[model samples]
Structure formats: C-alpha cells, structure tokens
Target: MVTSIILINAERTKINEVAEKLQEIAGISEVYSVSGKYDLVAIIRVKTNDDLADLVTNKMLAIDGIAKTETMLAFQAYSRHDLEAMFAVGM
Candidate 1:
C-alpha cells in the first residue's frame, strides 16, 4: 500500500467540518484535528500512487474550506511494540 500524510490548513471555522469530510473520502484512513502550524492531519492509504494523487487532487482539494496541503509520502513504519516483539523472537 502507498501511505501518505497530508497536512491540511482549512478555514478556522471549518476545521472540524473539513476533517469530517476528509474522513468520508475513500482511501483516507484517518483524519485528526490537531494544534500546530497546520489545522489537521490526514492519513491516506491507497493501492497505487496514482490513486493517492486522484484522492488528494480531485476529492480533497475540491472541498470548500481547504486552503492548503503539504503531502509527505511515507517510506517506512516503525513502532515500539513491533520492535519489542521482534527482539523477543530471538529469545
């Protein structure tokens, strides 16, 4: 799967609504309303890079209150629990 993190900036009044709308979109796995330089974060998982592009450009960007987006493609995933399990396997 192709995974990406999209940092979203929306109209202040519409941040929650934007997040709700994003969660409804296909291929958007998760949406978070956060406090930071960006208003929200969206996690996108798709079958292909082209699918990612289509979801972001055609679906997400077309939303009414979304102003800007910065997309970061994920290269790898690491978690402490997974790491611990791996080490325990050697025991």
Candidate 2:
C-alpha cells in the first residue's frame, strides 16, 4: 500500500465544499480544514504508486475549488508503540 498526505490550497469561500468533495474520492482517507499557508490537509492511501499519481493528477486536481497541492509520501514509520512491540519478549 502507498500512502500520501496532500496539502491543498483552495479558494477561501469554497473550503468546506471542497473538503467534502475530496472526502468522497476513493483514495482519500481523511480531510481536514486547517489554518496556515494551506487551507486543507488530506490523507490518501492507494494500492500503488500509479494509483497515488492518478488520485493527485486526475481526481484531486479536477476538483473545482482546489487551486494547488503539495504531496508528501511516507517512506517509513517509527512510532513509539511500534518500537516497543518490536523489542517485546517474544521469539
């Protein structure tokens, strides 16, 4: 599985509407309205790299209110819980 976080800059008046539309897309797992240089932040999970590309290029970019996007791909995770589990007493 491939996961990506997309930061979306949308038209000010259209933020909520755009966020709602993004939530309906297949690869988008989460969407939130945020305050900063960007208006919304979304989490997307797809089957492969091509799927991620399609979502960003074809789907997300096609949305009406979206102006621009910055995508970040997660390469590895090192959460505290994961580290503890990995070192647990088990063979």
Task: State which candidate has the highest lDDT.
Answer: 1
- What are the lDDT scores of the predictions, listed in order? 0.91, 0.90
Q: What is candidate 1's lDDT per residue for 1-91, written digit by digit as tens? A: 8989999999999998898899999999889888889999999989999999899889987899999999999998786854897789994
- Our tally of clashes for model 1 stands at 0
In model 2, the runs with Cα more than 4 Å from the true position are 79-91
Question: Across residues 1-91, which tens digit of lDDT does each residue of candidate 2 receive?
Answer: 7978999999889999999999999989899988889999998889999999999989887899998899999887666854786779562
Residue pairs with colliding backbones in model 1 are none
Q: What is the lDDT of residue 69 in candidate 1?
A: 96
Say what the RMSD of model 2 is. 4.0
TM-scores across all candidates? 0.85, 0.83
